[model samples]
Target: MATRTQILIPIGIAAIIIGAAGLISIPKDAKLEQTKFPMGIVKIDGVTLQVQIADTRPLQTRGLMFQEKMPYDQGMLFVFDGEAIRSMWMLNMQFALDVIWFDANGNVVYIQKDAQPCKSAIETATCTFTNGNNAKYVLEVTSGFVDMYDITENSKLEIISI
Candidate 1:
């Protein structure tokens, strides 16, 4: 009942629509691999930091794990699809960090300053820190970032780009 041209055109349009939607829908907990993910930037009151984005499964799971050293003002930002009571740990971590959580509106909701690193996954699991609040983003910066910037709860965040 339909010509080849007519039938193929609708199929092509449907495919494009579905593809675009897929690209727009990244889950909050989805931890994508780092190699394919792009870098982004975050700004605190007057300080800007170069940030690595971890939006998919593998990247989130391996976030800053076993890393050697993070230069000043450099960090990793984890983006989840939705906000929840998120928890983090220092598993296989090489150094301490200040784990900061941001709400959907980019306000600092919780912070775990001076989070100590653990030698093994088993040990780190027992030392998990949770915000007890909903957070769509989590940033891991050098151990003293919080104190250096004087960042605190309800501090505003600026996400430059992703």
Candidate 2:
């Protein structure tokens, strides 16, 4: 007969495997909260953008992926629980876009202009992943979004989340 430890070890392993699978399995069309956070909008020369806060790990990991298109005045605001370096890839993105990284204080830490969509498994200038390891928030928008609105480093992002 198998020892008690041996039997329990297999059960424990199975439990961990199941939990891991659940954590990694986020639906492509997961319907997260659609409510908008109440905060001052940042207008780059009066071009307004509606930002939706993604303050959870599941939401952050899904960062604009599998979206067919983004509305002209709409964008996603990825919020982290704490300050940590983060990076973004253009994998599964269907359109050319831009990513603006922000710090915990909502200051623009970095920006990648016109990030091209990845059409294949290979990385290219337009399709490659950009690292914003110093960023806390990653804002995804259409190509030429920043220049079109004249947004720059000094721009501030208002956060109304506690």
Candidate 3:
């Protein structure tokens, strides 16, 4: 017959080995690479920006989630099929952002400035979602981008290339 201690000792060691292996396999920061998405060029209020186009549902869902930070001259542009009440959240975001919604004609319909990130589990579960006013496109940039370039509801977005 086997002793309880003999069986327990091996189980404990196996647990520790499994735990360490799990930790080693996990990435410290799985930052989203820009090259994974198609690139676009857009201009808003005379400020030109290089943007990542999130045109598909999968790409839109993963927008800026794990990125540590973004340059002031760069942004993510969400393209939809038609104008509607689009919504966005900051779940898993690493930094704050300024979100802008545009109509089909490229006219700004709504803007959320300095939208904060949701870090903890509770915060992520309760993260607030911002909605647009019948918008066909959405743009997300570094927190201060809107104020820095004086982007307003009257501002228009020009897609130089996509």
Candidate 4:
């Protein structure tokens, strides 16, 4: 009886391992719609920018975390549900980026260019821009995107998220 029990235990363990392996085979399709949001086109200094609006918690928390690259003329617009002292950081960013803050009037209130990605020994807050006040939206783009597009203070940022 003891010998039979030992053999059964090994077989059970093998079966469990096989079951776990099957469980791990779940398909992983890239959730492209996860990044797509109600967006609009806005021209800054005659350059058009395609943007995705983010106005919810999930949208705000996942702000461009896994994106491999953003086009020079494209960006992600983070729309806050309410007015606040908005700030941004580059935690999982693979490349440098620029953050532009907009006030309630849809005007560019602050622009932080060439934002450095987070490093083990480096702090991003040191390089962050805190010039925005009661901002309602934040825009993220590639490094030097603002300068390349000539986006500056008083630049109009149209939103179709409403």
Q: What TM-score would each prediction reach against the true structure?
A: 0.75, 0.64, 0.76, 0.68
Backbone collision tally, model 2? 0
Worst 10 residues of 3 by lDDT: 22-31
Better of 2 and 4 by lDDT: 4
**Descending-lDDT candidate ranking:** 3, 1, 4, 2
lDDT by residue (tens digit), candidate 3, 70-155: 99999999999999998786766899999999999999989899989876433542355557379999999999999888999899
lDDT of 2 by residue, 51-141 (tens): 7666666566556666778876777777676766776656556888878888877788788888887664333233545564577777778
Residues 33-114, model 1: lDDT tens digits:
3244468988977679889898876677667765788986888999999999888867657899999999999898998999
Model 3 segments more than 4 A misplaced: 1-35
- In candidate 4, stretches whose alpha carbon ends up further than 4 angstroms from where it belongs are 1-39, 121-129, 160-162
In model 2, the runs with Cα more than 4 Å from the true position are: 1-47, 122-128, 160-162
Return the TM-score for candidate 1, rounded to 2 decimals.
Answer: 0.75
Worst 10 residues of 1 by lDDT: 25-34
Please say which candidate is ahead in TM-score: 1 or 2.
Answer: 1
Q: For each candidate, what is the lDDT?
A: 0.78, 0.66, 0.82, 0.69
3 versus 4: better TM-score goes to:
3
Compute the lDDT of residue 122 as modeled in candidate 2: 33
The pairs that clash in candidate 1 are 27-81, 28-80, 28-81, 30-56, 31-56, 31-57, 31-58, 32-56, 32-57
Give candidate 3's error at residue 142 in angstroms.
0.2
| Maximum-lDDT candidate | 3
Clashes of each: 9, 0, 0, 0
